[model samples]
Target: MVLIDRIRLCLEKLLEVFTVFLLIALTTIVLAAVGFRLLGASLHWYDEVASIGLGWLTFYGANLAAIKRAHMGFPGLVGSAPVALRASLFVISEIIVIGFFVVIAYYGYLVLDILAWDRLVSLPSISLTVTQSAIPISAVLFILCELLSMPGAWAKMRHGIDSEHEAIEEAIRMAEQDLQESRS
Candidate 1:
């Protein structure tokens, strides 16, 4: 259990780093695109590249959002349910989400396999598989984060913050604040 926890932590940190790098690349690409447009020399592939980058950014950003519990949920509907029903619903929902991602990861793997036989249109140096690979990677990361977050959700259900949830929440809040400041 301890080793598993450590591995989860390491994986989460790695995802965080990867997300940051993608965000930086997205920003740079957008800025460069803007600059090129200003000079009346836009790269024909800039829009396509930006679109792909945006997709990667959104997917990775979702994993980060899950880590912070920032992903939207139907809390109001859940709140109106009876206690026993609510608990069951919550568990079922998580299970469904996990299962859904597992399917997505599987299909993503298939897409990646197909892409292995092709290359990007403009970026021949990069395989299409490399781009599509983010799908399964992000899906698995999301599943892991969701599982790790179960204890926190359980804590909230008991109307209290477990120490683990509190610690993770505090870290997430701090990181969010830093991100906001950087953006400003």
Candidate 2:
């Protein structure tokens, strides 16, 4: 368990760094595109490349979210389950989530073959495969994140802990603290 925690920590840090790099690159590209457009030297590849970058950002951000367990969930529903049923429900939910990503990764890989000869309309030198590789790559990353986080998630579920509720409660407590400080 400690080893898994350490691995998750490393993966989380790596993802954070990569995602920040992607964001900076995307921002630079957009600013350059805009600057060029204003100078009447519009970049033809701007739209396509920016779109691809955004897709990459979303996919990779999703993996980060998966590792952090920050994705949307009906925690109340899950936490409300009877203790006897909670374990089964948790397992079923995990299997469904993981299985869905597996299918996505499989098809994403197959689509790369179909797009092998294709190139971006504005940048013929750049293969469509390169742009589209984010699909399969991020899907695999997400699955890995999901698996790495499962033990912690199982522990939480077994104890009927709802992360969402916990987050809200924490926020409320912080707000109350601030209010008390203001009063003082």
Candidate 3:
């Protein structure tokens, strides 16, 4: 379990770093395209390349957001719910997300299959399938991150020890302890 957790953390960190780099690349591509237009030269494929990069950025960014709990959700209602109800809601929500991703992965596979039969006219550098492949890949990774977060969130709700909240509480506790010790 520890090894799996460590591996997941490492993969998450690596993906985060890679997503940052992809964002940088996407920005560079867009800037280059704009510069070419100013010079009366058209970057014929720059837009396509940048679009693919943007797709990758958005997909992996979603995964990173899931890991960080940065994705926007309607947590206000859940937050106000009673303890038992909140736990039940959290578990149900996670299950629903998992099921949704499974369906997404399946549909993504079908789309890839359909795209594989067609040839891209303008951007011949890569196949349509390659571009479409990011869907299933991202969906799978998102599911994995959500699965990992499930246990931690479940444990936290059970004990009311959310790590982010607990960190703040611990900082305050330590500060208070320090003050008491100094006065003594």
| lDDT per model vs. reference | 0.80, 0.94, 0.82
Worst 10 residues of 1 by lDDT: 157-166
Write the residue-wise lDDT of candidate 2 on 1-184 in tens digits.
8999999999999999999999999999999999999999999899999999999999999999999999999888989999879899888889999999999999999999999999999999999999999999998999999999999988898999999998899999999999999999
How far residue 92's Cα lies from its native spot in candidate 1, in Å, is 1.0
Off by over 4 Å in 3: 161-184
RMSD of each: 5.9, 1.9, 4.9
The clash count of every prediction, one per candidate, is: 0, 0, 0
Tell how far residue 48 is off in model 3, in angstroms: 2.3
* TM-score of every prediction relative to native: 0.77, 0.92, 0.82
Q: Deviation in angstroms for 20 in model 2? A: 1.4
- Runs in model 2 deviating more than 4 A are 173-184
Candidate 1 C-alpha lDDT tens digits along 1-184: 5665676677678778988998899899889889999999987777768788989989988987776566767665665667777788788988998999999999999898788978777777778888888899999988988887666576575453334555678999999999999999
**Candidate 3 global CA lDDT score:** 0.82
- Give residue 46's lDDT in candidate 3 (0 to 100): 84
Give the lowest summed-lDDT range of ten residues in model 2: 83-92
lDDT of 3 by residue, 37-140 (tens): 99999888886788789889999999997876657665556666788988888888888988999999999988998898665566775689988898998899
| Full ranking by lDDT | 2, 3, 1
The superposed Cα distance between candidate 1 and the true structure at residue 24, in angstroms, equals: 2.0
